[model samples]
Target chain A: MKDVFKPEFVKLELEATTREEVLRELVDLLPVGDDKKELIYQRLLERENLGTTGIGKGIAIPHSRTLALKDVFVIVGRSKKGVDFNALDGKPVHLFFLIVAPPYDPKNRYLITLGKIAEISRELTRKKEWMEIEKKEEFVKFLNGLLREKK
Target chain B: MNKQLLFLISLQELDILIKEKEKEEEMGFPIKPCEELKKAREKIIEKIDAHLMRRYERLSERYGNPVVPVVDGICQGCYMLLPTSLISQKAKNERIHTCPNCGRFLYWVDD
Candidate 1:
C-alpha cells in the first residue's frame, strides 16, 4: 500500500470544483492514454451511480473494479476548498482516495487497501492531521507512520 | 476516436453499467434510470450494424462481456495469448475483431 501512493501521483492541491472534475483530475494522474483515461472515468462514474463513495469525515474513496486496470493503483488528491461529492454525511469532501484495480484481482487486494485507507482516514480525522498536511511527502510519511503503528 | 470505436466503447460502458445496476438491485438498493438507460442502450444497439449487434448480444449472453480490451497482445477477457500478427493488424485497423480463442470482440488500448 505504501508503494501504491507514489509522490508523483499525489496532488497536494486540487483545482477541481465538482465531483466529476475531481475524478477526472485524479484519473489524469494515472499512466494511461486518452481512451483508457476516458474508460476509467466512465467506470468511476458508474461506481458513483451505485452509491456515493464519499464515506464522510471530509474523505471520499472513489473507486472502480474494472477490466481497464492492469493492477491496483492509488491516487490521492487534496482540495483545500472542498467539493460537493454527495457524501453520506451531506458534507463537502476534501480528501480523495481514487482507487483503480483489475476486475479479477486475485487476492481482492483492493478491498484490503481500501480498508487501510479508511482506517488511516478515521485516525487522521480524529487528530485533524489530514487538514494540516501541506506537502506530498508529509502526507506519504504520515500515512506510512500510521500503517507502521497499526501493525 | 473513430466512430466504430466510439460506438463499441459506449456499448461496453452501457453494458457494464447495466450489470452494476442489476447487482445493486440484488443487494436491495433500487437503481435509478435503469429503464431509461436500457431504452437508450437499445437505441445504440440499433445504431450498430444489425449483424454485428446480434453477434455481440449472443456472445454477451454467453460470456457476460462480448467486448474486451486487448492488453499487450493478450485477451484480457480470456487471458489467451493472441497472435502478434493479429495484434499488429488490429492496431492498424480500428474495426472490431474477435479473439480466436474466446470469440469475444476485442479493442486495443494503451497499457
Candidate 2:
C-alpha cells in the first residue's frame, strides 16, 4: 500500500460536481501520459457503466484493469460537496478511491487492494473523521491509519 | 487512429471486462453474467478484419490478452522490446501492428 498510496495522488477537496467529472479528475492524478490517461478514463467509465462501483457509505471505488497501466495505481479524492454516484444506498459520494491495474496481475494485487479499499470504506462508514483532514498529507496518513487498522 | 484499430482497442477492453466478471462469478462472487457486454462483443466481431480476428483468437486462446498497449517501445503483452520502426510511428495507432515476440495486437499507450 505504501508504494501505491502517495501524497501526490491525494486531493483534499475535489472540484468535480458530477460522477463523470470526478472520474476524470481522479485520472489526472495518475503519473501517466495523456494517451494512457484517456485509456484509463475510458476503462473506468466502462467499468462504471457495467455496474456502479459506488459501493455506498459516502465512498466509491472506481477501478479497472487496462493494458495501458504498467502496474497498480491508487488515487484518493475527497469532495466537500458530494456528488451523486448512483450509489448502492442512494447516497451522494464524498470520497473516492480509484484503482487502476495492468491486465497481467500475477499476485492478484488489484483484487487484494480492492478488498482492502472495500474494507476501509466500511470502516469509513463508522466515522466522519476523515472529513476533518484538510491536507492531502493528512488524508494519506488517515488512510494509512485505516489500512493499519485492518491488520 | 484508424477505425478498425479503434474498434480493436474497444474490443480488447470488452473482452477483459467479460473475462474478469466471468472469473469472479466462477469464484462464487455474486456477479451475474453480463449479457449486454457479450452482445457488444458480437457486434464488434462483425466489424473486424477476418485475418486480424483469426490472429487475435489464436493469441487469446494461448494467453487471455490478444490486444495490449505499447509503452516506451515495449509490448505489455510479452514485455519485450518492440522494433524501432514500429515504435517510431508518429501517428499513434494509425496502423495495425503485432509484436514480433508475442504476436499480440499493439496500440500505442503513449504519444
Candidate 3:
C-alpha cells in the first residue's frame, strides 16, 4: 500500500486552475493507455457530478472504481494556489489525492486505501500541513509516518 | 493496444453513461438531457467493426454490460476463466477478442 503513493506520483506543484484541469492532470499520471485514461477521466468526472469528492479543509480525495485499471493506484498532486473543487466546505483544495481501482478487484483493497487517504487528509487539513509543504519528500515522509503510526 | 481496442473502450464508457442516465430516470431523479451520450455512442459504434458492434448490441440487450476487463485471464463480467490460447502472449492483437463464456468484449489489464 505504501508503494502505491510513491514520491514519483506526488506532484509538488499542480498547475491546473480549474477542477476539471486538475482532474485531467492527475489522471495523466496514471500508466494506462490513452483509451483507458480517457475512460478513467470520464468516470472521475461522473463521480464528481454525483457530489464533490473534496472531503473539505483544503483536501480532496477523488476516486473511482473502473474497468480501465487492474491495480489500485494513487496519484497525489498539490496546488499551491488552491483550486475550487466544489469541496464540502466550499473551500479551494490544495492537496489532491486521486485514487483509481479496477471494478472487479477480488479483494476490494482500494476501499481500504481510500479510507486511509481520507484519514490522512483530515490530519493534514487539521494541522494545515498542506500550506507548509516546502518539499515533496517532506509531505511524503509525513504521510508515510502517519500511515506507519496507524499500523 | 490497437485503435480498435481504444474504440471499444470508448464505446464501453459511453454505454455505461447511457445506462447510468437511464437508471437515474428510472429512479425518478431529476436528470438533464443525455443527448451528448447518445451522440457519443453513435460515433463510437460507427468507428468499430460492424460485426463486433452487432455482437455488442446483442449482448448489451441481453445483459446490462457488453464489455468487461480481463484480470489474470479471468473475465470480470462472468467470472469465468478464459482459455489459455486466447490469453497467450503470442496471440495476435489484430482482431478484437470476447469472452467465450459470456460473450462480452474483453480488454486486458496488464499489471
The positional error of residue A11 in candidate 2, measured at the CA in angstroms, is: 1.2
True contacts kept of 2: 0.17
DockQ, prediction 1 = 0.22
Interface RMSD of 3: 6.4
- Model 3, range B1-111, lDDT digits (tens) per residue? 566766776666556545555543342223336765566567778888888778877987888678787777898899899998888855334457888999888877662
Error of 1 at B52 (Å): 3.9
The two-chain DockQ for each candidate, comma-separated, is 0.22, 0.36, 0.18
Query: Pairs clashing in candidate 2?
Result: none
What lDDT does candidate 1 reach at residue B6? 52
Model 2 lDDT per residue over A5-70, tens place: 689989878999998899999999899988778878987887787778887778888888887777
Q: Kindly indicate the candidate among 1 and 2 with the higher TM-score.
A: 2
Per residue, candidate 2 scores C-alpha lDDT tens digits across B1-111 of 667877777788788777678554433233335777788788988999999888888988998788887877888789999888777768867788888999988877665
Report the CAPRI category for model 2.
acceptable
**What digit string (tens of lDDT, one per residue) describes model 3 on residues A1-151?**
4444687788978999999999999999888888668878988896677557777778888877777787889899998899999887899999999988875456767666777777666678777765777777887887788777665
- At residue B103, what lDDT does model 2 achieve? 91
Question: Which regions of candidate 2 are displaced past 4 Å?
Answer: A1-3, B22-32
Best-first order by TM-score: 2, 1, 3
